[model samples]
Target chain A: MNWKRYERASDLNGALTLLDRAEGTGRVIAGGTDLVLQLGQRQKSAELLVDVTGIDELRGLCASGAWIRIGAAVTHREAAASGLLREEAAVLAEGCGMVGSPQIRNIATLMGNVITAQPAADAAVPLTALGAELRVVSAAGERWVPLEEAYRGVGESAIDATREVATEIRFRRPGAGAKTRFFRLARRKALALPVLNGAVCLWRDGDAGRIREARIALGPVAARPFRARQAEACLTSDRITAALLEEAARLAAGEATPRTSLIRGSEEYRRAMIRLYLTRTLWEMLDIG
Target chain B: MDHGVKIRMKVNGQWREAETTPDRLLIDLLREEFGFTGTKKGCGEGECGACTVILNGRPLLACLIPAAKAEGADILTVEGLTPEQGLHPIQQAFQDEGAVQCGYCTPGMVMTAKALIDENPSPTEAEIKRAISGNICRCTGYTKIVAAIVRGAALLRGEAATTPAGVDRERVPQLPPVGPG
Candidate 1:
């Protein structure tokens, strides 16, 4: 709410320069669903808001080479409605669709969701599980940061947003036998944050065959969305039995470090949910019990 | 420092400009500056869809958007839906279906429907539910509201709508303007 001026960047270079000039006092305004809310709460302040909606480069969903690219400016609505994502990475599409409301999804950007780095941020759950990478750009240069290592804690990111902008979000386009699932339970069907959310990506050898690779990510279970490394290690074999799922769920439950929140849920409840959701997601994706 | 920033946008269909503060939200700008009080503010945290307005062809929560960032954008509020030709089809349908209880959430609901019906003239019942999921109505349940939207979609496609058996559709009451010129 303390912004001194507003400027719409005509292009990426102009946006970087404005951010560079504002030093730490500038905030990039994308969909403004998140940025504006933070500003309204006075949780975040700025001297300048470099509206990046004008930049053509930071928009749209595209598949390049081996990765599917999502521009920073791509809204939740756009991501949810994307036919390409629905076909290739339907989990991401489903995740984005479950954001807030039609109004929120229409303006809230996926990049904003990822940058906010909320442990339970819906978009980040799938991005982390699917091994998404962010393309960070600044006046200095550009770099690629994996979604897993990008954050240090809730609302904290290794990437300095004031100095750099998230230009794109991309992940590998999974091939045959690969499936991903995202599951979350909120108080209501809409307009409520997930009490606990989980996303899993796994691949089988063939139709009704052995497991190849697996990745699991849980949110609000820690300072940031985390990879259930031990659980994933359990899933890296052809023998994916119900016992294996049980073991992996137990591991994931141990992986979470949830807290007692008045709004969310208790640490014990969160742990139980991590196990249940992990079991359900694995069975649902693999078409088992 | 001067917080006044220039914003040029198309409201309804006409181009307009306003010098507002960087912190001035679209809901405030529309209600205070332009007198578009039809847009209400509820649950300012973007949970309730009462502040919804179409910005650049998408329904957005105005309370969460700064007016200065809306520059060059084409916005449509509930007022824009009304033409010299009378109430917009959706508004008429809402009235016909008795969808207005408190009338607080009507404007935002109608704008959200406009956004959906414009893109998909024949939206499925499921799609309609998904599209309006952001809007919350405390009275009359959402059944009538959803039906009104379905009928509104039909009306937009120029189809004749017959009142369901035992259902009486009312017209907007003709009342004189109250107070202030």
Candidate 2:
């Protein structure tokens, strides 16, 4: 409620300029679903709200060569409905489709979810598994930062919203022989935070019929989106087998460090779910019974 | 202190202008400035869809949107659905199907249904449930609300009332008033 001015930026430069002029008191407002709530609770304060939803260059969602770029203004609903994303990055599409609800999805931008930096953010979990990068811009210039490096802590993003704008999220499009899956266990289907959520991206060596690379991401289990490096290492260069899947799932469960949350669940329960969901996701990807 | 910003938006087919503060939520502007009280504010947060309204052809939580964001945009509220004389078909269907219990969630539910039917004229039952998942109806347990949306879709499609057996107008009994006469 302390916001004194609202300015809508027409382009990327304009947005950066507006933020530069605010002298670190201007915050970028895209969807405003999370930022508005934070501002209302006095969790955050801003002298000026530079609305970036109108920035033209920041609204692109297309594939360039090998990368798929999602603009900062791309809402969950738009990402969920994108045919390219559905075909190439279905895990992200599924994650976005499962966010708050249809109404929230229509306005909550993907970058906003990422910037909010909640460990269990639906979109952020999938983006982590996909190894996405953020394109950040400021008056000085622009730089591409890995998605994992963008988080400072729980509910904190490294990118200063008052001074910088996360222009877009870019990730390489999963090529042929690669598959991804996202799994979420929540108290209810909608309007509830996830008890445990995970995402996996696997690339198979077509000729050898072996796993070439794997990325397993889980959340609300750590301070940030957790990458199960041990589990991923176990799966890499390994043949698809029931025993290997079990070992990977177990490793993933071992890697998680979930805390007992009154809203989520007991730590033990979430750990068990990590193993269960990982196993299910791997089995489905490998076409196992 | 900063004074205020001038905003102009098309609300319910009428272009109106208003001076609003930067922090003013769209829901407050709709209710206080435009007198569109039909869009209730059950939960100020986005979890509840009681403040839902269609902005620029998409159904969004008005409580989460800043009034300045609505500048130059087109908005449709529950009040916008009414015709010159009669209730909109969606509202009529809700009444016919007995979807109104405490009547608090009705406006938001109706607006959500309007957006759904506008895009998908023949949405499946699952789609209907998914579309209104954001709306919380403590009364009627959502059975009657779901049935109302189904009937509303039919009415919008220009089909005859295919009221299901459970919500059949004849089958619903009239009860005595709660308060003493």
Best-fitting candidate, scored by DockQ: 2
Worst 10 residues of 1 chain A by lDDT: A32-41
| TM-score per model over all chains | 0.94, 0.97
- In model 1, which regions exceed 4 Å deviation? B1-3, B162-181
lDDT of 2 at A34: 91
Model 1 lDDT tens row, A1-289? 4677878888899989989998888878888777777876788778788888778998869999888999988988899889988888877888898888878888789998988878888888988988999999988899999998889778877777777888899999987678888888889888888898878888888977888889898887898988999999998877778889989999989977888888887888889988998898887777776
Candidate 2: tens digits of C-alpha lDDT, residues A1-289: 4799889999888888888888988999999999999999999999999999888887889999999999999999999999999899999999999888999999899999999999989999999999999999888888999999989999999999999999999999998788999999998887789999988999987734889899999988999999999999999855678889999999999989998888877888888899998998899898865
Clashing pairs for predicted structure model 2, backbone only? none
**lDDT tens digits, residue span B25-126, model 2:** 899999999999999999898987999999999999999999988899999998888988999989988988888989999999999999999999988889
Clash totals for all candidate models: 0, 0
Query: Which has the greatest TM-score?
Result: 2
Error of 2 at B84 (Å): 1.8
DockQ for all models, in order? 0.66, 0.81
Report, for every candidate in turn, its global Cα lDDT versus the true structure: 0.86, 0.90
